[model samples]
Target chain A: MSGDIVIEAKGLTKTYGQAVAVDHISFTVGRGEIFGLLGPNGAGKTTTILMLLGLTDISGGQVSVLGFNPAREPLSVKRRVGYLPDTVGFYDQLTAADNLRYTARLIGFRLAEREKRIGEALDRVGLSEFAEHRVGTFSRGMRQRLGLAEILMKGAQIAILDEPTSGLDPHATAELLTIIRRFKTEGVSVLLSSHLLERVQSVCDRVALFSAGRIALMGSVSDLGREVLGSGYVVDIEAEGSGLGERLALVPGVNRVEQTGIGKLRLHADRDVRPEAAAEVVAQHGRLKFLGVQEPSLEAIYTHYFAARPDGTLKEGARHAA
Target chain B: MRREGSAFNGLGVVMLKELADHLTSIRFIILEIIVMLIAVGTVYVATQQIKDTVAQDPFLFLKFFTTSRAPLPSFIFWLSLLVPVMAIGLAFDSVNGEYNRRTLSRILSQPIYRDALLFGKFLAGLMTLAIALLVLWLLVIGLGLLFIGIPPGGEEVARAFVFLLVTLIYAGVWLALGLLFSIVFRSAATAALATLGLWLFFYVIWPVLAGEISQIIVPPDPRYMALGLQTPGTVVLEQFLARLSPSTLFGEIVVAILDPTTRALGPIYLSQLQGAVLGAPLPLGASVLIAWPQIVGLIATSIILFVIGYVVFQRQEVRA
Candidate 1:
């Protein structure tokens, strides 16, 4: 990812009568970066994406895709940004290629270029073999892949995917993540929204955690985990000795220590205190049974952040909007 | 808010794509078959009946569309009903089908505005109806030629062509209604049922309701009832209420266009008809002039319905 920004939103808002679907929120996606919008089902992730795509009106604030304002210059923004809506649908009666042809025509691609682009896109998504098959016969995973192929066919500078891997199996999720990674390598900035945190965590360079029309947190997963989980590293130590937690707390860079069980101690530290904590345990005449530094997982951060909030309940009407 | 590009940027592509879908759809084929069978039956009956009375009728081609040979009404009578059904069939699922398929947002996310999608689908629906109606129109003309063994005068052909155009506009009104219902109702079945129900109310129930309403509005005069003569105000009120339906307007237009001897649509005094020949065919222009208000009424209804659908669609959220 470069220092150049591809998407920027400031004080973005969407309100429907008395209900606020997406309250004032701000975020940016840099070139060639993968930005995830992670939240629960009714958390306004989809509404924000729609606003950026200019599919819905932005009630307040500004959003720019590349350099053009999505609201006022949607054609220019849309021409360069490809969007895969939630459960992205295709014409069931049309063959996969025929469906792409319709999109290609809409994109104003000429005949020869359209066919070439469609073939290349299908091949890249591993849907080349099914190009002649009607989309109705495709499985859920294949439909998602076809949606990616549409983005690929557009040769868009930025791909905005909404719940791209919602219903995919583990194997399909891995395959889709690989394809998304390809977009990053190709220097196409990607902003994908998904509720599957851990599954998409590996690919996102940064994410905005949405809750009830507002972004509660935004940053890289590890950075968020550090801020939310209150530690850069979690060192767990297991040994048969009394006051093992006290000994680990004395280790350099270790901030807090908690005795989890009869022979277990967990340490929250600034660095990997595993080696030092292990040595400290042995010096205390304790047999070191286990010592491992736990990498902060996105699920842990998300769960921890929500659990700590006093009023994190999602609004009912936001569910209908998103 | 000034948009960067033309709102109609992708209109042709969307229209052609939707047009292809409409033409190849199984539902469209089934509708065409039923309309064809009805057209053939009516024209065959009309041709059979016209054979004996073919001696003096100047507009023999027009007779094929209006002549009833027992058990079956004239081609126009069947057409007035068939046009709406075919129109409703083509459009009842147009917008909602996209919602059900979950394809509306994906299509709108393309480099085009919502204007293109809505108007394109509408134009495509009208074009689909036009294709079928044109084919049916030519078939009747061809059958009239084959059975009557006489070429229709230019005036007869022109008047029949005007009838064809008026019927197309009438179809547009129902198409717009169906499209509106499709947008207003999410379920395709509900859209179809609502549109068909409205059509039934207008075609079958509304006229009867109008008669009752008009009588109430202009109470029956005992003196006129005893003489078996209707009160003037009651008849005018009844016709006015019935004309509110597109069906009545379509029927009136077809009547004026096909039968040129009909001089006036509304009530005319005896003094007004004294100078006119009893059975002389009016010029094509005169016939069109007579049906002009009804034709304009049909077009206006379609535009109003389409505008309503367009406004609703514009404000509607693009997500399923």
Candidate 2:
């Protein structure tokens, strides 16, 4: 990305009475980037989205979307943005096509173009077959897909989806993720929130982890893993010999060593210890059966971040990970 | 260029959608059927009685609305009793129903202003009520012409037209009340029950309460008992208290417009009536002039209630 900012928030703070929902948070989303807001429930993720859309009044701070101040020019901003709320709602009596038609009309689509756009949107979300069915009869996954179809019909330049895969089966979730990926190809910026770290790790180009109404960690999945878990790699070695743990521990960069089986050793090192550990085992006259490097997963990084401190504050080293 | 008033960008769409829904809903259809049956049935009975009296009555067409048969009431009375029920039914869920369905936030998130949603709902309800009243008015007029075999004069038509307008204004008051309750309450059932409760209180219990309050405030003097005349102060106080209810105001306007012989709604001096003919019908303009205060009261009440709903709805958060 060329750093062409599409959304910017500076000192964005929201307080409902004495409780601070969002406090002095700032972030920017680049054009055509899929930015994931990863947070547990009540971490202020939904509040931040509402503030960006101007659906709720800001207690204090500034936000701009598409170069228009959302607080002052909400209609102009809203016209260019699409929002799928956490609990997407539709008129139960109306069919899927009718619901999309209502939204198209509200967005000021003319009659001639509305029908074509609705068709294209429904087809994109894989809901073309159920277009004539009332939404009340739809499953949770179908309704979520219908919401995506509505956003598509609007042709919104910016799409903000909250908990998009919530209440969906594994297959439905995979289908939704694929559709979300297409938004980037079309050059539409997407900001989606989810509590499922695995889902976010799979699709997000960059993510901000929210904890206690603050961004505790933010970066690409690999960068976050390295920052929170330390600059290290695990090398697993299987050798049909004795004394391999002592031999691997003598390697200069190896941090720790563990035995898996009678002839297995797991080496934690800050650098690529695979070559050194393999050569050392061979030198010891041991038959090296298997040797592999294990990179830290996002789940480990998340657990490390939370388990690292009691105050829910990010460690100093992880602050600059973004 | 974009429209000058973008705040109301989606107003027409919302209004048209709501109006279509109201017209097609089962609740509105059932209410329309019941109201029409009662109105037509009473007018039919009144027509039978008026047939024998038409030879002597000059304003026989106006009698279609004001004349009563032995067991049934007049056409205007049935309208006065049923129009509020229809108006309340149409709007009691206008705002809260959207919340219950979880569509309020989604709709507000569109490019439209919050004002547009409430305004469109109120306007749509008023339009539906107006259309129903127009149809009922035409049906009665058509039946009158068929039974009496005489076309109404221009003056009679003008008077009836003004009466129809006044009736619509009266219905607007209740529609506004229903909308206000809808905005104040979160549940559709609670808003509906609250509106209906207010309606019943005003329609059935208010007159008796107003009379009792007036008697306590301005007691009748024993000095005038032998003359068998009501005290002017007590009567005025009672009428003023009763006018607080929209139904009372509507009833007064109906009487003045439909019954042209009604010289005044308040006290009339003996000197003012000396040269006036006893049975002469007032001109359409004069009747409207006499009931002008009542008409203004109905309109002012509707506007007041609408403003309250607008303010409350604007301040509300769209989270729910």
Candidate 3:
């Protein structure tokens, strides 16, 4: 992806009376990048999305989407940006084609062009067969897909999706993520918010971890794992041997070793100790079952950051990333 | 911050969608059927009564709307009462229903401004009411021509046209009221109930309360009090207070336009009737002049209520 900023928010803040929904936070989304906003419920993710769409007024700071101020030029901004809200409601009484037609008209598409675009959008979202069916009869997954079709029909340059997979099963979630990736392939800048760390990690190029209306950590997933977990590699060894932890701890470059199971031992080392450790295991005459390095999962990094404080704030040493 | 150019960019699309929905919905169809049946039945009974009592009357065609049979009210009375019912039915759930279904934010996210949605809904509701009223008017006139065996005079037709226009304006008042309540109340059921309650109060209970309040404010003269003879001041005050309700204003206009012999809507001095022939019909323009304030009153109330709905809707946050 080219390094061109499509969305920029500087010191963005939102306040409802005395309650600060979003504190001063700044971020930029580059074109053709999938940026995730990771936060738990009430962590100001949806509030931030609304502020970016100009659906809600910003209490302070500024937001620019595609070089237009959302608050001042919302029509101009809305014309180029598509938003799929958390609920993703449609006119249930109308057929899918009729619902899309209403939006097409709102976007000022000409009569001859509207039909062609609607057909293409339906086909893109795999909803062409259900075009004539009433939306009331549609399942949740079908509705979500139709919402994506609406965004495609608008020919939007940016899409802001708020919890696009909140209520979906694993199958539907995977399907939606695939479609979202397709959007990236089409060069559309996407900003998706979710509390599902694994899903976000699987799809996002970069993420900003939100904690109590503040970004506690922001970086690529691998970088964040390294930053939080430190420069250490976890090696898991399953061998039918006695005194494995004692023998593994004496190896060079090994920081700590612990027996995790009846015949399993995990060793933490500053570097790859697999080669020497294998030799030591063979000399000790232990039968090795399995030996591999375990990369830190996003779950581990998320737990590390959240477990550091009751309020989900990062500790002083990790605050530099914020 | 007003945007340049038209604030009505997407108005036609929104309006067309709403109109199509209203026309095809069962609610509107049921209302139209009920009203049409009652109107045709009332006119049929009135035609029979007119044939028996005034077969040779010069202005017999006017009786189709103004004549009251033994057990049935006149056509105008049914219209004044049921037209508001239809208007309220169409609009009571308009704004809140969108919120309940969670479509408000989705629709607002489009390129249009908030002004288009509310304005478009109002216009759509008004247009539906207009179409229904026009059809009913034609049906009544057709029935009159068939049963009465004579076409109405030019003056009678003109007066009837004015009456229909005024009735539409009256319906617009209730449409605006329902839309305002829909914006104020979140639940569709609550908005519908509130609209019906207000309709009941204005149509049935307000006139009695106005009468009592007028009596307290301007009691009858002591000499005529025992005979239930109200003073002119009491009568005028009561009339003024009753006209505050749109139903009362509509009733006054109906009486003035449908029955051209109505010389005045308020207390008429005997001197004002000097040299006037009894039972003579007033000119069509004169009848309109007499009901001018009631017409203006209906139109102004509709505008004021619509403005309230517009302001509330524009200020509302899109998040459901």
Candidate 4:
């Protein structure tokens, strides 16, 4: 409903026969944000994306993209959003230029501007050299780049990329992420879905960890660390004397106090409480050594949320952060 | 916020792409060659028949071009058999092949509706068949002038043109059948095989099987067989069942074109031709109009098949 909201879905659900794909879930992506939907395979990420694109019928709820209902107003939503599906295929016999030209014409671009726009799009994706070659002969990375080029040609306010860097090498992945970042700087909102946590962590400002057909956690990277992992800190200390473990556990908001080996305590405490716990430890045991606190990584949070799944099988609403 | 006819626009865009692909593809080239082969082969076979008839009786020249028989050597007869096969082969894989190649989803993503793809392909296939038919007719007329030493009369040319139109409709019937098969079958090869199987059933197997049933039902009353003894061709027991086949309808259209005195079948040839003159051209317009139902049936069948394909395509999900 707001200008900043690029995508809004409320109670969206899809079922094929008896199997529920995406079930009663809601989320929103604000403008100029790299929002990732993190889920493993068959977690309904693709189904949710398809429903948002108006390509699949939804059994329940509603979806609005760019302030238009994708089901009833797909054309409008499609016009404002560029989508790079997991894989993009082209007319195998046609040259890349011809393919792009055809796509341009289909989308109602004027013939006069087609050549120029296609050239610019290819250049943007670093695929200008392969413009005249048949797309069938293209490598996997080249096809991915071309798919990005097609999306760029849409000139959309929002981009929905479903695993954009799925099959790419490290170099290609970095290239695609850089292009996505450039779009972000240009004020385009991005909704990317991927199982690759590292890729999502690097490119996204915020992420939704999907599990059991819902967002288990959703928020910005740092917000998640500070809020969920308590300022991203963990303390592991080696006690020098008796009763050090019990003394550390007595601290307020100390989550866990574990004894590792002879006179060692690994303390899991909130970041704010860590300083106090350490102060108390130093006061009581002067011979204490190996006292340190490590910041929690995105990987750690991802695993924590994934491990907390009640059914032990991650669902679509598995995104967790913030 | 602004959703104005993007699906319609997508359809148009997709149609243009599909038409271009069809026109330039190897499949079209191969189909064209196959059609040419059929036309040439028919012409060659007919020339041999004409030469043998002429050699048997030099005085039968007047009856050669005009006859009231059920089957004759007119251009229409040859067209009836060849055109349907051509149409079937050209279109059988049109839609299913795209699905098989995983190109339908990709193509659909480009601002086009499903209707455009089906309609565009249908129009293109018809156009291709029209071109082939026109060339074949020209070749036939050219050969007739070269070998017969007589330029065709106005009525002859009119009849020939009407026959060409009939052939076009016959081809349309097959195109519709092919499109239907394409929609029903997922693989292009399977679609093609299904169309061929249908063709074989209607053209060859069904009629023969029906003959046995009809004979058993009506026990070949000696009276009926005796009455038909004077008929030029053998009246098989399956004659009634055979009439339901498309091949039969097409054959009737051909006979109507060649036979001037072909009136209501109940009357004997002697009475039917009582008022008709020898070597006169029949009213071609009246004959086509008489067979209008069959022509319309073929056209309607084609449209229905295409509509089914269109609906199926639009409803299908496009995966990456």
Best by DockQ: 1
**Candidate 2 lDDT, A193-296, residue by residue in tens:** 99888876788888888876678888888778778998578889889877778878999999999988878788888888888998998998999999998856
List TM-scores for all candidates, in order: 0.93, 0.90, 0.91, 0.80
Tell me the TM-score of model 2. 0.90
Interface Cα RMSD of candidate 1: 0.7
Candidate 4 lDDT over B1-320, as tens digits, reads 44357335655565556666666777667766765665555555555566655553322322333322334344444455557667777788877777665556545555455666777777777877887788877876666566556666666677777777877877887887888788778777888888888887888887787777776666666666688752223344466567667776667665566454454322246765687676554476776765666667666766776777777777776664
Write the residue-wise lDDT of candidate 4 on A32-88 in tens digits. Answer: 988999877777888888898877788999888877887777667666777777766
Query: lDDT values of the candidates?
Result: 0.91, 0.87, 0.88, 0.72
| Every model: Cα RMSD to truth | 3.2, 4.4, 4.0, 6.5
| Pairs with steric clashes in candidate 3 | none
* Listed models, DockQ each: 0.73, 0.50, 0.59, 0.32
Could you give candidate 1's per-residue lDDT for residues B141-205 as a string of tens digits? Answer: 88778877888889888888888888899999999999999999999999999999999999999
Determine the C-alpha RMSD for candidate 4 after optimal superposition of all C-alphas.
6.5
**DockQ, computed on Cα atoms, for candidate 3:** 0.59
lDDT of 3 by residue, A29-119 (tens): 9999999999888788988998898888889998899998888888898889989988788899999999999999988999989999999
Model 4, DockQ value?
Answer: 0.32
Off by over 4 Å in 3: A229-254, A261-300, A311-322, B224-228
Native A-B interface contacts kept, per candidate? 0.81, 0.62, 0.63, 0.40
- Candidates arranged by DockQ, highest first: 1, 3, 2, 4
Docking class of 4: acceptable
lDDT of 1 at A316: 35
Candidate of highest lDDT: 1
